[model samples]
Target: MPTWLTPEGKALSCLEKIKVLNENLTEIRELCQEALEDAVLMGCDEPQVRQVLQELLDSLETPFENK
Candidate 1:
């Protein structure tokens, strides 16, 4: 007999997906931070830098359920 996707199977898949997404989001945040730092070094306006960082912060917020 074939094994079916019980509740445990579903939870495992969800956990894996969240883990991958979390890693990707963290990397994106770091890249955004680096970009903002480079802009600062180039003497970009403070307000523009803040706006870019804020957008990155927003994207990092996940709506996933806590285990």
Candidate 2:
């Protein structure tokens, strides 16, 4: 499990918040693994699929950004 961090880089101190974050990350990892497996089974290039997924994540915008 990774140490959940705040936007300012401090480790999260709340147990509940840390648990939620860890759970969410685990869920995302499982979903991504399934997607990658499906893509590979459909004859997609593994590296390309991974790269596309990385790009997709990189393109995400955080709605909580300070205005």
Candidate 3:
């Protein structure tokens, strides 16, 4: 589990929010791990697969903006 932090560098304090966040992360991790394993078994380059995943994450856009 990670100590999720806010943009201001403070640790997240809401238990319900933290639980949801951690659960979401766990689900993503499991899915990604399965995909990585499948790719490796199919002879795909592990590093390339990882790079693509990172790029996908980097390309995400959020509609919410702080005012």
Candidate 4:
């Protein structure tokens, strides 16, 4: 996506930026989930687990849908 679009300094509309960001965010979310589950297996605290996971829920929300 970084390759497909202009550099962060280059021209892009707000909508396009949001689209790319959302795609990148989705990838980040999957990676976070995998890592968080590993932490659980390693016996992280329940509150710690929930606290760490809150970011993913935040990422899943957006006022606009790229689709």
Candidate 5:
């Protein structure tokens, strides 16, 4: 079996990865919210700010896949 399929590895793999991803995404969301609030306070247009953030989010996707 592959290393990741071993008993200890399985025990420590998928859930751990998902938990870490969730934590990172949560932190990014909080930071983005704070930045967007600051941008609005400084008179940046809300829609434009959201568009830029959306593009940034899109860039993180894998190429050629419909995910």
Candidate 6:
């Protein structure tokens, strides 16, 4: 009954959503990699940078929680 459950919608639902998600994740990973490299070049501690990134990922996993 949902708009995305209609025949036309079904044709463009899960697969399209997954494709977009994959694309976004890939791009985000690349950007994060670049950011990490830049931070390291700027004399930031790599381990600390990675820890912060992990914390950010953890925050994303529970967006409703006050991180």
lDDT of 1: 0.71
Q: TM-score: which is higher, 1 or 3?
A: 3
Q: Candidates ranked by lDDT, best first? A: 3, 2, 5, 6, 4, 1
Alpha-carbon lDDT, every model: 0.71, 0.93, 0.94, 0.73, 0.77, 0.77
Counted clashes in each candidate structure: 0, 0, 0, 0, 0, 0
TM-score per candidate: 0.54, 0.90, 0.87, 0.46, 0.65, 0.66
The all-Cα superposition gives candidate 2 an RMSD in Å to the true structure of 1.6
Report the alpha-carbon TM-score of model 4 versus the true structure. Answer: 0.46
- TM-score, structure 1 vs. true: 0.54
Candidate 2 lDDT over 4-61, as tens digits, reads 7787888989999989989999999999999999999999999999999999999999
Rank list by TM-score:
2, 3, 6, 5, 1, 4
Error of 2 at 47 (Å): 0.5
| Error of model 5, residue 35, in angstroms | 1.1
Report the C-alpha displacement of residue 23, candidate 5, in angstroms.
0.2
Tens-digit lDDT string for candidate 6 (6-44) = 434454467677677678888889989998999999999
How well is each residue in 22-50 modelled by candidate 5, as lDDT tens digits?
A: 78878999999998999999999999999
Cα RMSD for candidates in order: 9.8, 1.6, 1.3, 9.3, 8.6, 8.9
**What is the Cα-based TM-score of model 2?**
0.90
Best by TM-score: 2
Whichever of 4 and 6 has more TM-score, that candidate is: 6
Which whole-number lDDT from 0 to 100 does residue 26 have in model 5? 82
Query: Across residues 1-67, which tens digit of lDDT does each residue of candidate 4 receive?
Result: 4434454555566786678787998897788878778888999886787776786577776687554
Q: Pick the candidate with the highest lDDT.
A: 3
In model 3, pairs of residues that clash are none
Task: Give the higher-TM-score candidate: 2 or 3.
Answer: 2
TM-score of 3: 0.87
Off by over 4 Å in 2: none
